[model samples]
Target chain A: MNSQQIHLASRPTGMPSQANFKTVDVTLPALQEGEVLVKNTWMSVDPYMRGRMIVSDSYIPPFQIDEVLEGGAIGEVIESMNAQFPVGAKVSNISGWRTTFISDGSDLTLLPAVGLPDQHFLGVIGMPGLTGWVGLFKVAQLKPTDTVFVSAASGAVGSVVCQIAKLHGCKVIGSVGSDEKADMVKAMGVDAVINYKKVDDLTQALRDAAPEGIDVYFENVGGAHLEAALNVMNPYGRIPVCGMIADYNAETPQPGPSNLLLINTKKLTLQGYIVMDYWDQYGEFVEQMGQWLKEGKVTSEETVYHGLDQAVDAFIGLFEGKNKGKMLVKI
Target chain B: MNSQQIHLASRPTGMPSQANFKTVDVTLPALQEGEVLVKNTWMSVDPYMRGRMIVSDSYIPPFQIDEVLEGGAIGEVIESMNAQFPVGAKVSNISGWRTTFISDGSDLTLLPAVGLPDQHFLGVIGMPGLTGWVGLFKVAQLKPTDTVFVSAASGAVGSVVCQIAKLHGCKVIGSVGSDEKADMVKAMGVDAVINYKKVDDLTQALRDAAPEGIDVYFENVGGAHLEAALNVMNPYGRIPVCGMIADYNAETPQPGPSNLLLINTKKLTLQGYIVMDYWDQYGEFVEQMGQWLKEGKVTSEETVYHGLDQAVDAFIGLFEGKNKGKMLVKI
Candidate 1:
């Protein structure tokens, strides 16, 4: 069988473009014993993928030229030699940016039909959802009385963080790049939403919103957002750094927060984390997050593209803040 | 009775000079009920005091002009009306920079003679000791297999950190300002010492010393030292920020590490703490540290100034790296 896949054509120097990706057709071999064939339906595009595109050392390996780009995906089992994965069963896998793939079943996770859309397995009820849960509750050690400021609060991981903080009885302040994203996150129970693009002075805006001072800062966008958070943070404030989307494509290394010394003067803790570290608690998170979803206490939002060919565009759009929540490509 | 005291005559802009302090003789007031008179024997001078000299909000209140500067001190109670404190009892209090003081006995802590010199209470067994203990074990969550790096390794707190990490069977790398300080820290059993003054590239020097990368960074100095630590830190590294003495006297904000994005890529935790936060564990710490001293497992080093008149110079000398270990003035 033939399948359409996207490959890295070249390394990106700054903002990645369609020129960095090449779509190709590859023939799939017949499934051997214990192998399962998956027809991918939903593929994820995230900010961390930007790091993988660069030719440098990172937690994950860089995507090589003329090779299939990989990520989170939800697929249907079209054929299976393994008894555990029956034909027509739905599953989640990490062989994304492709229309169909043959896997040994080791990297695939069984996905039960939970009544929500299958794409939710690629978003709010999946890795992005877990990222928010662990970073806010465990890493930041969120308190019920904490006033939290979330940058890029309209994005995938950040939207879930906003809703979770609100549910914990925290005063939640969200910063989004547009009025549209501000309205979306506000609907998710964010107490105050700052349209960062509309603000002349972000620090002044944050000070006005959090008059008492922020106790926890969920850092998604770096650069100016980090500096603003440092300015308005209270003594002993905690910052759980999940991503730095603002500097992901910068041509040169960006200077850190000018007021970084405040981390000492204010006795703050700034910790960075990846969700893979908490994978052992994934089942526990799913139970609680699943309940919240059923109770309508949390909502999942996504911006979906129609075909595998649009995967590269979906990824590049993330840097431009083109998606409200999770950005996905349906194959 | 008349006693001599040093007061902050004015706030300093950059490096403080002798003009910033004023020496005055003040007459003691008549002791009231519950009041006790203390004759200070030794007073401590620390780098953090530089921040208190500036008129700004901090963990502690700013010192007012013409007021006696406060810090750790050991004294003998020459006269006491309170039954809990005997006339000849030794006490430790935060009423320093003066030869004698009158107290209500509320802020004073009774000191039992531990067989060590009285000045040891103002140093190795006091705040600086507790600072290293809590920063290494509590904040950094250090483990036996960890490789630790300490900046200002010859300073009061950094010396203790080096010894503690060595006792825990961890490899220790220390950065010192001069060959003399380097030899002093090396005598404390530091595995490797980087004489930063002699190095052209501090990061390369650290890389050579800790080829496997450092797991815990005892941050006593900021600026170049912090930048170097950031470069050679292993994944999941912890930085317990004790002090930033290098930037204590900067006239303008100093630029932070440009490669701070490594915090995210390496999943690092940088935590800032003050000893006051760990006061509850003081008794537990003193018990262990006392045992270590008796067994000759740990040692205290001091560079003493002869008179209370040298208090301001002792403090300013800290910025110039004038002391090898604890800098104290014997009144």
Candidate 2:
């Protein structure tokens, strides 16, 4: 018998409700040939998951009804028949929201390191880390003197972007929702932080932060913040768009930017990219980020939640700016 | 002994008024040693000229009140004392809104005959051509088999983009203002043409036209057209913003596709650029465009205004979608 299980009950309209989720306690399925049973150690709750709930045709499919919600996760193999993933092996995969999952050899890959916290595999040294590096250095083409402005400054991707900018010898400024987050990001080595909610004129605040104007904008939260960033961006600026958590739960996203045309007049390069699209370059990216990690050139932070039942609350925290770093759920 | 000129009488708030212009014929100062006085034959009337008149901080300085409005023009050197440019030599330069101009041999570059019409210099061989090539090929990084949706399908820059897409074996679709314009673009070998003014359901129209989804969007008219384009874009689609003529004459451009957050989820890339920044590559651009023209691979359409007095009407036609191709004032 398994301990706990979670499944998708209904598709969400705007922000998801508890009614959309179904928590269950089901007996574990018997492992078939070449299959293993994984006891999920940690699961990720991200803005991208909100996209997966809708029936819209996208690069990826929406979650099927009654199926377990899946994302990047780290787990432990308690029963394995496959030699590649023996019993007691720590593994990582996109296994769904279940305490114990019976699967083929496909979903789980063996977790590499011995001592590192397994949760960090779903945060810093994993997908989020790849997202930050790919968006900044490769897509935005980060230069040494380039000034960077990240929205949602204290999120997993934004926090790492600030640290990476510091290591790259670039000026970094971030916009967050609270004074505490602003302070926390400042501790992350960002040169300046703006409490966007406290400021009446975001444009004026950005001008004060980046006098020469931003060269790289790692856009995470989009809305009035993007409007403000657009006004302060220098000519030839590169905006590497990774996410827009602001509108993730919105009933209707903001229509479009009014001054989007300024992109032409200012000669700006606002590029939007999905991280998995750059999967071919992952080995090279992991190499660089791993080197940065060992050299103390990059650091990571996380806001961890206790269990599977708290996943809903962890996701809701993103909208309210509650997480200091990545908002995660540990099971 | 003199030159007739139209001087910038005032700065415009939205669209330039007749009062914002002053027509005058002035005596030309005597040419110094190594000087030439070129008789301007054709002056390029562009949408950018409208923006340049009002904006303060830009690549080019705003035209001073009562000073001749300066822009790119092709001219015949009726009189020359400079060795590099002899009499009857054709050249392209920023000589201003005037009939004759005296130069000290500093700015003007002699036009090389790559075997296309002189008007082609203003259209396919000039800034518009360079803008399309660089924005599509360089900034957008368009690939073969990529689907492209271009706004202002039959206009100067957009027309060339359609040809380039066809040359690179891309499935090209375009948005225009009228059925006539749509027919014109179709003749250019674009796979599909949707009249944006006629179609209210632009997203549906684009989906019906390019069902696979848009990979490259050559943004010329950035309003509802862009909003529609964003809805159906494939992940990692590229928007090379060249012109947004839809809002150029409005008192305040309306907010569009507020759902710009889609840029992140879909991983769309939007790089806005002004062609002058890519002037270093002009030689290569002209050579390629020239070869395409000679080989009968690409062609152009020009709406020639007979005199400088018609320049205002010609400029206004762009907003109304009245011109068939590159709008030029022949003096």
lDDT of 1: 0.91
Chain A TM-score, prediction 2: 0.95
- The regions of model 1 sitting more than 4 angstroms off are none
lDDT per residue, candidate 2, B234-310, as tens digits?
A: 88788888888887877875886766877877877788888877899998998898899999899887888888888
Q: List ranges where model 2 is wrong by over 4 Å.
A: A279-299
Please compute DockQ, using alpha carbons, for every candidate against the native two-chain complex: 0.67, 0.70
Candidate 1, residue A21: Cα displacement in angstroms equals 1.7
Q: What CA root-mean-square deviation does each model show from the true structure?
A: 1.7, 2.2
True contacts kept of each: 0.71, 0.85
> Which candidate has the top score in DockQ?
2
Alpha-carbon shift of residue A322 in model 1 (angstroms): 0.9
Q: Which pairs of residues have clashing backbones in candidate 1?
A: none
| Cα lDDT of model 1 by residue, A1-331, tens digit | 8889999999999999999999999999999999989999999999999999987658899998899999999999999999888899889999999999998889989985567788988889899999999998999999999999999999999899999999999999999999999999989988899999999999999999999999999989888899999999999999998988878898987777667778888899999899988989888888888889989999998999889888888999999899999999988
The CAPRI quality class of candidate 1 comes to medium
lDDT of 2 by residue, A1-331 (tens): 5757667899887778888888888787687889888888888877788888888766688988997787877888898888888989989888747677887878777876634578767777778878988888789989999999999888888888888888899999999888888889888788999999899999999999999999988888777777888889999898988877777777866655577777888888877788888878867866777777777766667888888898877876767777888777888
Please give the distance, in angstroms, between residue A73's alpha carbon in candidate 2 and its true position after superposition.
2.3
